[model samples]
Target: MSLTLSLQRSLQQTPARTATIFGTRRRSFREHGDRVARLAAALRSQGLQANDRVGILAHNSDRFLECIMGVWWAGGVLNPVNIRWSVPEIVYSLDDCDTRILIVDKAFAALAPRIGATARHAPLFVYADDGAAPPGMLSFEDLMEQHEPVEDAGRSGNDLACIMYTGGTTGHPKGVMQSHMNLWSAATMRLSETPILRGSTSLHVVPLFHIAGLGRVVMQSIAGECQAVLPGFDAGAVLEIIERERITDTVMVPTMIQAVLNHPDFDQRDLSSWRRLGYGASPSASVMVEQAVQKLPNVELSHAYGLTEACPVISSSGPAHHSEDARKSGLSRSAGHPAFGVLVRIVDAGGREVPRGVVGEITARGPNIMLGYWNKPEETAKALRDGWLFTGDGGYLDADGNLFIVDRIKDMIVSGGENIYSAEVENAIAQHPAVAMCAVIGIPHEKWGEAVHAVVVCKPGAELDEEAVRTHCRERIAGYKCPKTVAFRDALPLSSAGKILKRDLREPFWAHRGSA
Candidate 1:
């Protein structure tokens, strides 16, 4: 019925089964359940009440998983702090949410003093890192040992569950409020579409603070499967874990997948146990998809497309969509069909549905959609209109009802009179053998209202000039779609989630022109 109930079911059904693996440490369902209950008691003792916000700023670890469960068990809301955020960003979220309790891992303990000093309310700090608790903080292990195990609060349905902060690529991060029903429905609906393998072992490489990673965690818990938690993503380390732990399934962004494929250990590692790979967050190049298919012939690939406001998954492209036949039909490039129990439509600016094959804003409606943005009613009103979450993404549905994402609505380039989707241009650039990664943005032009410009990262030892890049794009796309100027970099700026930061790329050019 709820996330807590799901965990209880798993605990009841498989008390002795392995629940989580972090490095050399392993915990059974019973052990994890007991710790979760005690942690809940500890939080309650520290003044956590129904709907109170508790924060966790940590990397992926068993404690991160426990912190998530413990918050709900204590009848509190979770605000998982972004590990990549600076002290100011972290303070803004905590202050905005009025969080009074924060759990920090060793990697982020240094941030406690700064966050406590700046936040609206100085929070009680619980150190979950290795060794003893630093000065003023409470030790997570000590709390578990000292407190009595408490009963589950039995929170379910519309009860507030989490306030996940967005990446803030556009502006200050807004907390997306997720209810118990929203997250439960999202995990269940996704599983209904792509059933998890029984007794499977999943690896957690993505940050638990993000929707994609946290959503996967909820799904894995509901399935009562084994989870292996990684501190963070390391290409070689991931490969080693797959071989050593016999990880059966995992989720990653396309960029992470590409890194794994490009790793030196990729060819040498014994990864036969790995069966399913789910990727999303950004569009995948056809070339990279081909590389993944070639390198991991036995692995089934799936893609999810959604944003934080939608509880993260509105549609999923399954293994069938990645087949050779589907690839040839261009279905592989599509964001796939609307997810189970979710309604999706491409709507024009007036909120009317656009005809198939016409590009428009992608909107979705479902029980899984967030309650609203936390403490921002006006912004929430703008995002959720007439029961539909108007996703600021430009895309179209094909005749076959497959959704093809073009680009973020804000990222589309209007060159002269033509509308150029950056994804299309970037995809074309990716096809070139020498290009490793690329991001296309619109810049102010004297002749054209906006010019198509590209920032490219070439493959190692690969040389590419601006004209050569333009020539390559011209061969595959229209002249207006080709980049008028190309700048090469050893690497492209990437967000923590592995998405290209186009806002960062566009800032310099637009700043001088005094245009967005």
Candidate 2:
């Protein structure tokens, strides 16, 4: 069915109930639904035809949620801009998808002019920030005020819903085309596995551009509960919000969980209201999990494992897997069993199904799987083979069908819960004037799960330092994707065919730890 059906149900059943909380501002479902409908009418007035792509460049907010619903309500595909992306990266996505209108907040309003100048067609901008609309742009509030509420477009099934861009293996981001059914299946699948409590208020700290964060938003929408919105993550703010808002449910990456526990005011806060805590996006350390269990004794801790192509949930480990005995047996570290209605398999290089307990590429089949990569048939073909999405992660299934992620077959790094492809970083490093050749790899990091490390061989007569390398990369890519540490090398280890041996480069760092 259509995602808008949830909004309709909320309006009919719980119209007066609080739907969103942002700072001191609150909106009931009736208010939220009205705004969403008006926003939809405004989008149609702006020439948003059925299935047309609309982009949103902003931090997480109530307005962002409304914009997402509004676009879908108007039967348009969403292109949620990644806040971490550089101007070039942002422009590439807009141009690649031909997004005709961009809804931007004050944080990214400055980049609009450059993006407008660069994209194939300059998009009409709708300012969604707190202040007055900037020059030559329409105000978000004015649009809702001017347009009357319209009926939902009722798009469903295989109709495209979102084109979420993820870090690409070949250095440019690939837009993953998710259908309405895919998103619906993803949210419902999670609901079947772990039902949300009635009237539960969930907190939003993660970026809405990511699948995990947006998936939670959709789940909350369907559950018709309250959502406490935040622009971004801050440990102190998170603690204060949870205690202030009485948030009952929330999810975050392991890094965020660790930060919240490590906060100076952790023990002083009244986090007793929080009942369920979900952690994922990166592997969690047992020490962090133990600290969470010990500190928040009443809360339930769960973990999920998936990728963008799966609309993001392939497997989830519930509270049972986080039990004391499970932790001692290392079952807590497993990604848990396959999600309901999902088919997971560990396959060999030739796409042959490998026996359980044998490490291989993780492939998943389900209705939640994305339609395909936007306009990249070859890449899509390689990813979706024989109705199964061949996830580039190397993992194995235990006897109980629990997935254990060992290594990433793709040249990628997950730093602070954000995916950073090594090729993207290496492409930036090789552009440096003093670099002859370079390779990037993930190294063990205490704070971030993994840090981007660059191994470089500068030209024989030229010179380069860590700062120079980092500075150069920062100019080309997002700051997080840049190398956290750079090492000078006479030459990198290579295989027989002259390919750089990245495994050898990562050996010393991961040897004692046992995995990358």
Candidate 3:
């Protein structure tokens, strides 16, 4: 069945059950279903048609969740704008996908005019804030009040569900086309592997724009579980919610988990209701994992590894892998075996499967694999070959089938749950008039797992400093994509072919890092 059908099924079976909680706002399944239907009707009233793209630029809230369901319900594709991206990045995605309608919250209201000015086809702005609509924007509540509930559009199977834009190696963003079946399969496969607990109440603090966060939402909906969403992450706030709301399940990146654990009130909170803690987007430090195990001994920990193109669940290391014996055996560091219904292989450049324990590019074939890259025939051909989605990740699988990540073949850095491509950062840095050349690389970071670091060679007699280079990048890209550390260099190490040798550049910083 489709995502729309799943929501309807929840409404039919658990109409009176609490569906969502955002701050003091609580919605029962029946109320949420009615709201979703009205929102779908509202979208149609605002010129949305079958397969039209609708954008949402907001923080994690119940309204954000509603917008996601509403898009699918109205037979429109979703383009959830990355909350951390700069205005230019957001506008690029909207323009690239030709999104015609955008929903903005109070947090992003100021960016609405800029986006409208830059986008080729200015989107109809709908303010998702609880208060009155801002100037030149339609009120979300008003639309709901004016429109009557509408029937589901009944789109399912291979129909496009979302166009998730991911960082590109070519210094641009590529929209990964996720079909309804892809997302459905991903959520089902994950549930098969790790069944959801009955009466589960999940805390959603991770940004819904990311695959990890959206995947959780889909999974929770399928299971008819209640979700309590936070607008953004705050360590103390999460602890308080877990205690007060009796949150049982939640997903977070390692950096966020570390921050929560480091908070002074962590031990003072009553977190006994937190039964499951899923972490991903980057590997967790062994020290942090150990501390979590020590402090929250009863909580089951899991880690997943996937890319947006895979509809995001390729493999998951479950609680068993986080056990003391498994940790001692170093299995906790593995990305784990392929998820149910997913086939994973390590293949060489020619697409031939490699021998076990041999490092090669990770390739996956599954119903969860994305349709293709939007408006990028060349990239689609390159990534999807012979029915296999070639993930540009360097990894090896042991005889026991546990996947061990070695490095990134595409030079992508995941810092604080955000993907930052070296090419993007380098492109921004090179735009500085004083910069002659620059290469960006991922370096080990204690809190973020990996940080974007840049090594630059300035032009002769050109005055440039680390702050100058960083400031220039911030103006071009998101702050998170900017290099956290800058090192000036006379020249970069190059291969015989005149190509920059990134391995050589990364060696010094990662030389001491032991196998995870």
Candidate 4:
């Protein structure tokens, strides 16, 4: 079955159920289906071909979900533009993908003309805001109003469902191809019929452009549950929505969760409806995890581990994963076992599986694995081989099979011919009293191949001295693993998912040097 079939199934099973809640607006499955069918017919009559990429450049709304279903119903692939990107960045993505249509909303209506200017192929532009089709633009409602509610396009499994553009940390963003089956499998990994997930009203604050946000959409659509979507994450806004909507389950990266927990109105908001809170992106600190559990004892904590290429859900530590021993013994740092239907193994450079508990590249094999990079055969070849996607992550599995991801493969610092995993050093530094967050990178040195350098964001009202940090690490890790130079910042640049943008951190220092 395809994503289209799933949507059709939900529409048939629960016609009256509230499918989407965007601010005060709500749409039931039956209503959503009708709108989507009309829009799909509109798109098809406008010459939208099977697998042609249609772009969406806006925030969360009922219209966002509508556009998604409309695209699938019309047998088109989705190319969601990054909201954080600059005009040129967005333009570059649209140009690179050759997207023939763009669906935008009221929030980004101003940038519509600008995005249109740089689009090389000059695709059709549709506004989700007003039915009025602007000069040189098509109206979203016009599509729905014009087309007939015909049968589904019947795009089957393995068909290109989306071309998700990865934010270019190194350079231009590249589209990652994902099939309907790939996404379906990833959804099963978390929101399956497990008693832990059923009957939960999922809150979506993350932007739809990112995999994590889209991941929430996947879960909600399959489970046939209600989604309370916030246009963008505002601390007060999120808190108010939770209490007002009686949201039951939500997922976010640690950064957003930290902000929500630190919000002044957090206690004032009635969050008793929340039962399970899933956090990921960057691993949570022991202290932060402890505080969350203490503050929200009624909520079960789950963590997911995934990259954009993996249909984004690789493995998850579910509600049942939390244990008193794990919290006390600090074993909660582990990312937990491989996701169901996903085969994970640590492999060496030659693609041979390494011994358990050995640090090597993480490889994942599943239907959830992405088809490949869009239109780039060589790059696709590098990623997908023998049905195994070689994930460029450095991690290990314990004898008990709990996988622990340390850092990116490129982030490992090789100094004096010894491999020093940056995450190990960063974790050590993070444990210091003064360090709020830290990223360790290698800097060129004449004597060693690279020297361990620490860029730390110090905690509020705390003083961090290089000597104190170095001394603290010497006690816990190898002496050579300690940072030779510590640089202080108010905060480290992070991705929307809260993962430290190590490439951004390292580029300033290493860009002029010969090697990474």
Best by TM-score: 1
**Candidate 4 residue spans exceeding 4 A from truth:** 130-134, 193-196, 514-516
For residues 1-516, write the lDDT of model 4, one tens digit per residue. Answer: 488776788888989988888878888889899999998988888889998889998888888888888899999999998777888988888888789888887777778778777778767888887456667777888778787797888886899898898877665677899898888788877655243356667888888888888877877887788888888878899889889999998877676776788788988889999888888876535545766888899998888889889989777776555677886655688787888888998999999999998999999998889989877788889988888889888999889898888878887888998999886787777777676677789888889978999988776788978888899889889998889898888888877655677788777777787444
Candidate 3: residue 59 Cα off by (Å): 0.7
- For candidate 4, the C-alpha RMSD (Å) to the true structure equals 2.1
lDDT of each: 0.91, 0.88, 0.87, 0.82
Task: Give the per-residue lDDT of model 1 (tens digit) for 1-516.
Answer: 589997899888999999999999999999999999999999999888899999999999999999999999999999998988999999999999999999999988988899888888889999997899999999999999999999999999999999999987667899999999999999999999988899899999989998988999899989999999999999999999999999999998877888999998888999999999998977646778888999999999998999888878899899999999988888899889999999998999899999999999999999999999999999999999999999999999999889899988998899888889998999899999998899999999888899999999988889999999999988999887899999999888887777788888899999877666
Structure candidate 3, residue pairs in collision: none
Candidate 2 clash figure, as a count: 0
The prediction achieving the highest lDDT against the true structure is 1
**Candidate 1, residue 286: CA error in Å?**
1.7
Q: TM-scores for all candidates?
A: 0.99, 0.82, 0.81, 0.94
Native RMSD of candidate 3 (Å): 11.1
Candidate order, TM-score descending: 1, 4, 2, 3
lDDT of 1: 0.91
Deviation (Å) of 88 in candidate 4: 3.4
Q: In candidate 3, which residue ranges exceed 4 Å CA deviation? A: 411-516
